[model samples]
Target: MSIRRAAIWSFASQYASFVIQFATSVIISRYYLLPADVGLFSIALAAAMVVAIFQDMGISRFVTGQPEMREEHLRDYAAVAVGLGWGIAALVAAGAVPLARFYGEAGLAKVMLIIAGSYALFPFSIVPSAMLTRALDFRRLFQANAGSALAGAVVAIATAANGAGPAALAWGMVAATLARLILVMAAYPVLPRRPASLEIVKPMLGFGGSSFVISLSGAVGMRCQDLIVGRMLGVSATGLFTRASALAGQLTTLMVGAINSVFYPAFAKKRDAGEDLAAPYLHLIACNTGITWAAAIGLALAAEPVVHLLYGPNWADVAPLLRWTALAELFFVAMPLQMDVPILLGRIKPLVWINLLDTFITVVILVVASFWGLEAAAIGRILTGAIWLAIYASYIPRLVGIRYSALGTAYLKSAAVALAAGAPLALSRWMSGAGAEMGFISLLGLSLAGVFCWLVALPLVRHPFWQELRLALSHMAKLRTTQA
Candidate 1:
């Protein structure tokens, strides 16, 4: 499949998963689980994720980015992947006790133990999944992911309702991983062979070592807030922060995350073909910023009603947190393909340093702000995001020869669109009295108005995204006609 087609399929799959997961979160948070329950699970998952970074150890990227490889090479990578996966699983299981003791939560140990089981199954699927990705066979990928997400959602919801608490979340993840493994096996039934020579492992390790460090740093940066909140402020605060972060992430994931899954291979192909990446990269920035900015602005404007309606009164504090996170996400989506572009260009060293810098900055800010409270922590993220954008701006131009002026121009129309789109909701909130009680219907109506205004503003601003959208629709039409 073409890159565009692959991205479309990936987006559709992720969108479906997003909806299911969103609903599941609502049900579990509102009825089945307490804040502490969710918090405990979040903490356990966060710790497991730090260890889980080593599970794939860049093997998937190695497989996907290579122009060609023999069956032997594939088997070699697969064997190494399996070894890393089991090793990480063992590490996590062993660490569970100390992690739980440090956090002073006995349940976390159980949750971590349950989560560790999923790591062992990860190796079984990673190679096949990478092969599918390299071939642009996103349809099968979609099937695997969507099926697993559905299965996991069901398991999580059922178990949560049955009062399994955080264990439900852990077991649900295992189920998802198992389902994905089964589907991937069905899709690409290639068995891994043990490597006979050390040569295969050497080169992979060299590339993978840098990738692992980058992944580790990024994970730590992202999850450090959860650790700080859980340890310093307690589980309930961590739960609230996690919920807010998840809600804000939904918009970014919907807009850019799926496209990113396709972009790495796409960029690698371009690099292999000796094509200049500046034009495509700039276009991506414009389009991503346009859509994401509008969504972020809308979410921020409607934060109060959204939190209340979806998660009930107990989660009201999450609204402000969501609003701040939404703002940070705007900057994030501005450079959705940042890491992919550099990695594709074989410039992993600078990227690793940048990630380390980001992790250090994030942890420092989050730690200092944690003393104030959750809202302060949320605000610190926005500050960190702005600073990171500046940091990225300094390096990206030097690395890729893209002008900063071009990036600023790309953001201009989107910023205008966001401001215009958010005006109606802002007005509604003001007119209804800032503290006025509004029902779900009222909030829904205002949200519709905001969307309508956003659509109207698009053409008025002469946004480049409008043309892109038209071109996409035209392309889809032609594809349909050709298939017919």
Candidate 2:
């Protein structure tokens, strides 16, 4: 398939997941799950993600390395994937009770164990999903993901209506994975059979092994906050925070994750073929930064209204936290680009150190935040993002042989333009009262004011934005010219 088609497929799948997730989160947070229940479910999901770190084994990338890979290689990868997943799932299950005890929630153990068991089913889908990406057959993968998300949401809603509470959340995952597995298996013609020879095992183990460490460290760095928050703040607070983060992350994942998915396949191919990496690398960074910053800022600004509209007033506490967290994600938008570079370039060692540093800082912040408040945890999150950005400043240039100054300029230019646009919105918010009704008239006023400020100021203050503005307009003009 063409690159555009692959991107469109990935985007459609992401949208499908987003719609179901948004609806479920809205309903479950407001009506079904209590604060404590949300906390426990968040904790359970976090633990499962930690296990997934090691379980993944980076065989996805390894599979892509094989140019003429046969059905036999697929089988062996499948066997390895199953074995690894089972081992991690078993470990998580074994520790579930202790984890619950540590968190002072007796039922958390069972919750975690149930969620951990869901990992065993994950391996059944991994190879097929990876193969689909490697083959650029996103349509099939999209079907699997869309099917899983839809089925999961339906099950969660049904079970919650039956009064399952947080357990319904876990059950949703189980149902989704099952749905995804069924659809993905059906999408492919080949069926799982016996394992192949151990020939490819060494290289697979070597490449995927470090990836496992990176995934484990990265998972801990990312979700260790969930564990700490659940223990310190209790389930309800944790749940609220998780829901907030999930909403913010949903936006990031939709944009950054979609691009990263496409980036890996496209650039990994270029890297494999000894293609000139500089242009693709620079293009990816520019595209990623522009899209990510715009979305993150837009989300942060819109967080209050969005939370009020979707989750209702009961979740009022989440708005500030979501806004702060979304701002932090502006720094993190560049993170996916940093990570994909090393993985694709086979230069993952830097990530080991980077992730370790990130984990230490993240753990410190989360623990300290727990002592003070969840708001502190949010601050810690922003700090963690700053650390990632700092590391990228030093790291990306070295990896690609580009000067740090050039990198700095690109980021600053984008930052300047975004700030130029965003400053007016903030001013308007400061002037407007929260009590004011957000009606069509008010929205139209704000929209018009924002556009007026952006259009007038952008042309005068930010030359780079003006240039891009002109280029975009010129392209459209050219299209018009062609039509005429």
Best-fitting candidate, scored by lDDT: 1
**Predicted candidate 2 versus true structure: per-residue lDDT over 151-172, tens digit per residue:** 9999998998898878888889
Model 1: per-residue Cα lDDT at residue 175: 89
Model 1 Cα lDDT, one tens digit per residue, 75-191: 777888898899999999999999999999999999999989988888989899998998888899999998998889999999988889989988889989999999988998667
Candidate with the greatest TM-score versus the true structure: 1
Model 2 segments more than 4 A misplaced: 65-68, 189-196, 420-424, 435-484
Model 1 poorest 10 in a row by lDDT? 429-438
Residue 41 lDDT in model 2? 82
The global C-alpha lDDT for each of the candidates, from Candidate 1 onward, is 0.85, 0.75
What TM-score does model 1 achieve against the real structure?
0.96
TM-scores for the candidates: 0.96, 0.89
lDDT of 2: 0.75
